[model samples]
Target: MLKRKISDYLESYFTPNRREALLITGARQVGKSYAIREFGKSHYSSFIEINLLEDSIARTSISKASNSKDLLLRITAIASQPLIKGKTLIFFDEVQVVPEIVTAIKFLVEEGSYQYVLSGSLLGIGLKRISSMPVGYLTVKEMYPLNLEEFYRACGISDNIFSVLEEAFKAEREIDSIIHRKLMELFRLYLIVGGMPAVVQTYLDTNDIKKVVNKQREILSMYVEDISQYDINNKLYIKDIFNLIPAELNNPNKRFILKNLNENTKFSRLENSFIWIREAGVAIGVYNIEEPKLPLELAKLRNLFKLFSNDVGLLACQYADGIQLRILNNDIDINYGSIYENAVAEELYSHGLKLYYFNSKKQGELDFVIKLDDKILPIEVKSGKNYLRHNALKNVIENKDYEIEKAYVLYNENIKRVGNIVYLPIYLMMFIKNREIENLIWKIDLSSLPQ
Candidate 1:
């Protein structure tokens, strides 16, 4: 398996003197189970893994125990190990199948001395079933589809075009046209193929777009299967919402409006079903930012929201018809503004920031608004060349309602700063990791801060 950045997150979660049981939540086939095992092999002396799907007996055994110690003993016996506390890492894979396993995790944390990491794609929806439990005993680490930088890394292209691109970003300089042209081509392919682990690995091995699309379809099929089985209560509605995705993208607004489903459908009828998709990590909810300032959640208009599918490659497949890989062959600027912006939003989300859209109603809209250190930074994405359209950023600056430090426009090339804003290549959004960006921010002098 390709190494993931989340490995470091797992290492820290398990190593801390003040460690807590962890809940790893993400969409299915996103490498959650594989990651847990990889992490265990690297960090723990002994690892106990239980797949709730394969071993129904294991689920029954863990569920029957009343206390943490008994449950630990039960898990150890199922894995055929002694119940050695504090030395072994216990992982519950496909944990959503048995909700009681979640409660049991909390019990173990409070009453026993073992480290634990529980994970499932369906785990987010499963959270709603909890009435009460040891809430403070667990921490959550949410994962998303791979970002562009990670995609290149996984493909083993990090040494050449990837490293060159990273240097351009670190220095905030434009890339050479030749390299830029080549990298942009890869970036566009990534948009169409996406960052799903299975899809990418298949493409890497076969160099086949058809195989990649097939893999994407398999993932989509699983969501459909889940709606029919686990989400049976809302089956028809889930199917209805899933079918709306293609049309939703074609809409200029791209927000999920119930009327968009069918002329006769009402918004009230699909509210919980929408929540179900977001909770299941099948869709991401990008709320409208009423104001670009602190307390971004305050700006949310519950009824007006933009939804990005869990995978960009899947979205591309939905938008494009057969025999048109030619579009990706040309350039990023030709036909990928909305799709690239959605991919950028996913990248930002992986950095642990909630995605919000800047809508002025009268003025133009910014692509994303990210909150960091209680400050809202408006991020506008463009596949166009470095031509600054700072009207939206200007509006925020002139209003003075929110102290706008600086705005970012993610374009196809790097740009010089003008006034209180900086233009950046959207590629950097995928290439630069959060820690590296955080370090960049630390090195910025207030004296040279954008005015």
Candidate 2:
């Protein structure tokens, strides 16, 4: 089994003298259940697993229990497993379907008989329906699709490769050409296979690109089915927007145009549909920031935004016929710039960065805006070879109205510093939050580097 970074956090959570019940939430098919099960088997003496969606007996028993002790007794009786303190781990998979089970979590934590890890696919939506949350009693964590680092590890890539990349990034130097090409090859595969555990696993098992794409299509179908099953009222509207993401992103102005969906469509009417898709973890929204400044959320123009699929591979699957082949063969002739931009957004979002973009008719559009310490860094992503022609980034930095210091331009290029702007390969977006790298970029004298 491939290791997930969340496993390390879970290990610490279940270490000696645990205090709170754990709640793991993420999108469907992202491997919440699998990761929990793996952690349980490796860390616990005895693991009891219950799927609320499949096991009615466990659900009824849990719902009927009066207190923590009663709930433990019911669970033990139903699961036919002994619950020993400090030795047992109880996993509740898909607990979002049962609101009563969620309510019991407070009592279960207070009981403290066994460590608990509760996981659900649609927990975000379920959280809205929850009347009383287990505040201050449960530790919460969100699991995303496997990131680039995790994907490389799953493919048995050496950690030395990443270490070299980190060194190059900190020094603003290019990596060895041979190593760079190898990493880029793996990155291309990542674009096709995505970071979805199921899709990644299929690719690993077969090494067949066609099989991987077929699995992605199935996952896309499952997302639509999930919408139909959960949001019956807005199923059509939700599906319409979901399916239109590729088209919306490919436009010159990447902001999702309401007119494209329906000329008469009002954002107010379809707001919930958008919320449902985002909360479900199937998509991420990048809002337009009218003023690019600190406290980005406050400056967001809610109605003006672009929606990206949660996984880049899924986006590629829906893009067009033979697009995957073009991407694989490096024969891409279409406007595939949005695909790389979407990948960058997906990576930054996985690292817990809220998505925002700055668009100005006068100053060209900036792909992403990130706040680092006291500085608001503008990130421009170029999928083509012309990475140096960043007029928007230059204009944004030069504007006296906005107090911008330095900017980052991500493209298919080696790491280098040009004036106040740093050029990085798109794959290195994963390291934007590294402490050492952040410090190096902030303190380095860009004047020392040749233009």
Candidate 3:
């Protein structure tokens, strides 16, 4: 079985401190069900799974229940395994088909008889229509596909390599040359293989890129099926936008032009299309910011943005066949700027960073700008050897008004630093952790006020 970081998150945060039920959300095939099952069976004495897709009768049972006790009775009747009080963890799969489960969970949670963990094949707008979604009663945590580190572990990379990599990233030192070459090869393979669990597993089992691409295509088909199921805005709007991601990303500027979706149409008509794709976790949008400054959302030009596929493997599969070989071969002649950017976007996003880019007439475009360590840190993704030739990054750093302290340039090369710019290996993006700033304890004394 593939080791996941979410297991640690469950053990450390959700298991010990779960006052509210947790709903693990992400795109389908991202391994939400597997993670939940693994954790529940290991942690609790009794693990009861209720899959709505398999048992349609549970939907009626969950909806008709009036109170917490009744809801528990209905769920227990449908559960596959024994539901022992206090010792059991009930796992709800494909909950989207049974929206009533969202309402029933609050009552079940209040009753406090058995622990509950819920997940579904789809998220975002799938749950949006829930009129009373037990917002405070249910906490939500998203699970992404196997990220770079998880992929490394799945590929059986050593801890010593990870330790050395972590140390070098922190110290701003070049990785050992031999290890660097091998890791770069692994990183390129990651671009083709991506973090999707099923796809990764296929590659791991067979050691074949052909089988991996086939699995990726199946997931893409599932996404298409999911889009058709929801019919958000218009089915065409969502599907077309999704299909256009690879081509649009290949554009010079990479900003998704609404006009391309419909030549005579306006963004007003197709707004929900983009919203659905984002909410569905089918895509990540890096919006254009008017300036590289604090409070990026306020300065965001929502209409102007770059859209990337949710997973890089799926993105590669969307392109022509045999590109995977080129990537694995470390092909440099091909224009893979979009692929590199997508990997960075997916990595930063997995780290819980909201993405934005800086573009102006005078200063060139920065691939990504994020609020990290309490400042706007611009990121530039380079696929070619000329990683240092970033004019836009220079302009943003040189500009006095932006007050940008430093930036990161990710490439398939060794780590180095020049002045305020930090150049890191693209694979090192695995360590871009999600820090907790919510409980920052800071208080100024007002007792010294002038009397």
Candidate 4:
């Protein structure tokens, strides 16, 4: 698949004048190595890849080297390639295996002379362990599962998909019915396949359900392995937390509760385990955002929060054989609500926002609290048109001063605005970023807006 966007980000770091050491961070098997390699091939004349975990000699060489320059020489010798100045790219894969190697990259970028990319699966864990080092020494690039645009490219759809969407966004017109249908089809597939690189690529080449299942299973298996490597002491607790997500998403509250696992289980008992899961990039905690502003942290819920897995594809697999059918709104509507919320959670997670939710002591619950620009936007997720009764949304609108820019409800239809509330189709949600839905909000004129 063409991951041009991520490559574009990497390009800025490698641009000769804008030289910086790159730290490619993501959950395991999200294609960090493949992306770094692709960038090197396209941008550099000679590329050298160092597998720090697989090669003992290279590890020893790096450790034994007296200084950063000596280490560079040893890496070049092991790669059997000349590390030319400016024209060569050096990739340090699995650099987290040796935390000190990250320190070395900072030295090489500032003191020595080389274009470098460093990547690791347990990158978050390593960073926490190595926190005393300089912070701004390297630029960080996050690689997520292939987003919708990338998924479209990987699926071999004509570039027309993006071009048409861009045109519609620019021209401010309704998309042709055929194009909308096609976009929806690709979107449904994305909901099922998710943006994981291996899963997307598997669907691209084979289009086989079995193959897709195997890839998801493989990625999950690798995560299981990571729990052991990264959290061996609390491995059992971590496994329990991981296994409980599919069940917890089924709950109406969605905020994780240890009691939901066992009536007696306590938060303090699983706090470290949950933190480990977040650090591993396998699951993330969405805190409550009470207001919108520069630092969204001021409005966080200390006790209640929701947890989302890194990829929706794995979450789908954990549920059933034909889970996509649930979206049609059958007798399984309750579970479908959980899945829809999870899907929305995945989209929000992709944007790298500080997520929180809104709720007053006597007021009801809203699905999400997201900050866009200077506005703190309250978002509510509805599985069907029936739930858009706007009880929760109306509560937040009338009672709270809340920066109160505007409110959003993600449901199953075209965009509509009633009073200060805007209703958006769940599919268009993938495009919402920085908490500003203005681009999406404008898609529907507020006058003939839904009530």
Query: Among these predicted structures, which one has the highest TM-score?
Result: 3
Tens digit per residue, CA lDDT, model 3, 330-438: 7778898999999989988988999999888899999999998778899999999888799999998999999999889998789999999999989998877656658
Tens digits of lDDT, candidate 4, 228-283: 88777999888888988888887767778777666887777777778888877888
TM-scores for all candidates: the values are: 0.88, 0.94, 0.95, 0.89
Which digits, one per residue and each the tens of the lDDT, describe model 1 over residues 1-451? Answer: 7778888788766764545788889988888888889888677777888898888899788768878778867876898565456678888888888877777677777765668888887777787786665578788888877877778677676567767776776666777887666666677778878888888889889988888888888988888888887787888988888777756755666777777566897667778888888888888889887777778888788877888888888787776565237556655435456686678877877777788888876666777888765676788776655456657767876677788787777776654467777777666776433443333434546886678
Better of 1 and 2 by TM-score: 2
Candidate 4 Cα RMSD after full superposition onto the native fold (Å): 8.0
**Best of the two (1, 4) by lDDT:** 1
Q: Which stretches of candidate 1 lie over 4 Å from their true place?
A: 16-19, 81-85, 110-113, 159-171, 331-334, 384-391, 431-451
Instruction: Identify the candidate with maximal lDDT.
Output: 3
lDDT tens digits, residue span 1-451, model 2:
8789988988877876776788999889898999899989888888999998898878777778887777877787877567777899999988887866777788887777788889987677888888888887787799999988899889987888789888888788987888777777887788878899999999999998889988998999888888888888889999999999999988887889888878998999988988988988999999999878878989999899889989988988887788877887777476768888888888988887777999888987889997765478899988777788978888888887788988889887678898899988877887887243444444667997889
Ranking by TM-score: 3, 2, 4, 1
